[model samples]
Target chain A: MTPVGAVATIGRLCRITRVTWLSELLEPGRMVSTAIQVGSQVFLTACLWTALYAHTEVSAGLQEHQAVGYAVLAVLASRLRPLSRDMAPDSFYRHMREGTILYWFLRPLPPHRYHLVRALGDQAHGLLWVLAGYGLCTTAGVVPLPDGRWTLPAFLVSMFLGQVIVYQLSLILDLLCFWTVANSNALHVSHFVQSLLSGAFAPLWFFPGWFTTANSFLPFQSTLHIPLSIYVGRIPVNRVPREVAVQAVWCLLLWLITRTLWKRAESRVAVQGG
Target chain B: MAGGTALRRSVYRLRLSWKLTSLNVRARLEYRVEFALGILAGILWQASVMVFATVLISRFPGLGGWSSGGVLLIASIRLLSHAVYGVLFANVNRLHAIVQEGKLEAFLLRPLPVYRQVVLHQFHINTFGDLAVAVTLFSLALRRLALEWTPFKIVFLCAAVVGGALIEAAVQTALSCAALRSPTATADWTGWLDHTLSTFGNYPLAILPGAVSGLLTFVLPVAFIAYLPAAVLTGTYEGTLVPREIALASPCAGVVLFLAARRLWNWNMRRYEGIGG
Candidate 1:
């Protein structure tokens, strides 16, 4: 599967995992009732989106396509967990000092893979709910799919780039846990900044001139706006290659930084007591 | 003697709470770098809203007969309300964490009222950033609109703004009580609600569909925060009640909501079977 497809599949599986656990945790009756209530809430939101879009001048096809892009972005962003201060160098170092990393080390999974799986498990259900809600919105004509024939190809490429950019940026934020104790506020601020800069809360077109000019050159825009613009047919089809090329460069830069940090972190990880 | 002693004790507690809150302010100020950055972040966030409004106005010229300055008045009031909420009731927003960690139990054990303790427990000193932004925006609006500024008009405007803040805090606290009963429901919904109110509240309620306008006016009382007051202030909404009665009464909705929320909180506290206890 392509990375986007993989992320989607993984996301769905994660949702299933959490749902099964939650079902078991709650009494069967309460589980069913809660699920139904949450489901209706999602449905209502979709209906509202649909109602709003119906009155607007935006075409139906564009709405549906845009909804899909939003869905994909939401799911991926939700799944890509940033490192919490509670679980970073201090916690990790303490765990290592207590020989706790040995538990995972002895297992078949590598530490990074283990962390990734754990994040997936933790976020699966929430991501699934978002996806299901997005799907409902799309079906209900709340989300206008793009009209142009080029929307599909452009969206697909732009989404891939968006995912890579977001994942890498999050990975870098997580890496910051290696150096700082109080990064939770930093993470929260970053999320807010990203939402505004990345075009998640609304389209980048809505931003002011100076902000638009500044954000255009940043990798943050690649995370959401690039794909959104593509879906809206605002970006020409010919630009897809160049956009993806920029995303690839970002991914490589982040990867190199992450690798260097991981090496440094490992060296710093002295088993003090053990 | 007993009554006098009891009165003294209550005053002492109030003083203690004030000191604690001030200490939090002091602690936040000590981190000059983080504090400065936080202020900058606040400005940036406010700029986003202003920019959004500017774009909308530039495109449409006017929304539902309201001028840009009028809209800014609404924005300023909304930000002011948010700042008040942030400063006074930060823990109300963090109810999920309080619930999850069994922190609510500690508040229960205290001699003070649960509502007071909960409200006073966490104070986000950073909210001064929002307050600063609101003041700056309001000042700009005053200049742009060039309203006939009589002393009474200024006093009424300030009252309306402060009252709007109180109401917002009350509504937020009341909604937060839901987390006490439904732990699984996302507390982030409060943020979503705030966003929805902030986004739609800046525009004239009349521009929205009648149903939506009615819901905001009656149910959410968001109209009182900005729209109605601005209307009265600008003479767009004509009535004997505009400045004298309605503006004064509008803040009461917040007070009523807060009183009801306090009751709900008390009831929820009795129901709390401490998490992991």
Candidate 2:
């Protein structure tokens, strides 16, 4: 493509992102809500970890600071694709229900690219919240800085890969709506599962050996746990490469699967009112 | 005659609620597989609490001097009451959408109380899963406790569960008043409160620092939902900020709070211009 064409495409994608952001912009209250929720969550999470560590110096190979740091960071990282962002029934299923999904096929941009660009926008918006919270918490001394010189760089790389895996997994969930029209329950269940398995609710560390071992086989932990563990230095700087590699492999597999599903989903689409 | 009229009124409400609930459940049943998965989701929803409670007990042994069994009892009480709240009153959480869609205007014209009509708008299909897990945990908690099973204790336990549900209802009801004015903003606050409750509500607040604990007690009153009652049962209510007498009357707090909140809701409704205007 010509430079002019490429620039125009980039500009259009930026505008396409409004599907992910226009509502929040239209209602500034949502922004205030995000601030309050993020702040309180970090505080509450930090307190819980510190309280738990009060009795014992180390449980599951993590000290007060390490565990506290991990828990606090998990709360902030969760801001990346906060659960509440999707609570409003808008997106694929709503579009399908309202019989407007065909617009995806008719648009100049491919449906899959449109879907992904929206997620990209959502994550970008979420990243702003994450950065602000991270800065505030680190300054406030609620959360500590990375101890190792390479820890911050390694964590950022791993976190980027992990988020790619998250976007693909979300795409798969979105595609399932083509098959199951009333899949709200499935959506809720999937969110809870992701939160539980990804170590957002609690570090996979505190869980029993069997639970963590089982979680290793799933892609969910690649989304939040690995990056967070790397951040807190629990997974060790040496193992960061291997962990990021594993996350990369999951991303590749999910990408292929979601790509194929998007093709099949087009044919399976059904409108709500015949 | 007044007493008879009151009894008749109660019966009428109950009968209408049952009819509406059946119709709602039937609608849910149209998607059989999704309905089944929804129940699983409900159980999973509550299971997150259980998982945290289990991890805490197994790893740490005791929190705030409360034993595993005592903590489990507190959790079970909160979960069961939560099931009751989920079934009967959680619909208020969706009030923002209702008001935005102009459904509230239609509800205001109905003969029944608007709150009741709004609540019974649809059955909470997930409560089936919630109740199953809650009952199972309560039973397990019972087995763990070595306390004497006196009739008074059993009755108080039941009352505490009801009180816990009422307190939850009261909180959601108060939040719904804001939904009338700013549907979008209130939605976020409502979601935040639910998260805070689910995340922090199950534990013994005594374990937290004095300031945070006091916030939960005085500002939020989440402790009265189950922690204090469970603490009182386990004999750990002594260190709490409230007097022993007030702690013992935790159930009464739910009653009084619910009544006051209901009155507030009525006043808020009268002032409600709604989003449509």
Predictions' DockQ, in order:
0.16, 0.62
For model 1, the superposed segments whose C-alpha errors exceed 4 Å read A1-108, A118-142, A206-210, A267-274, B1-11, B22-46, B238-248
- Looking at model 2, residue B241 earns an lDDT score of 85
lDDT of 1: 0.62
Candidate 2 has an interface RMSD (Å) of 1.8
Q: Could you tell me which residue pairs clash in candidate 2?
A: none
Candidate that would win on lDDT = 2
Question: What fraction of the correct interface contacts does each predicted structure contain?
Answer: 0.04, 0.57
Best by DockQ: 2
How many pairs collide in each candidate, listed in order?
15, 0
- State the TM-score for model 1: 0.77
- Per-residue CA lDDT of model 1 for B1-277, tens digit only, reads 9999999998998798999788766876655644565666666666656654554444434445567777787788778777776777766867766776577788778887877777777667457677887888888778778789889777777777777777777777777777786644534456556656666666566555577567778787888887777776787763222354665466566677778877877777788776522
Model 2 misplaced stretches (Cα beyond 4 Å): A82-89, B274-277
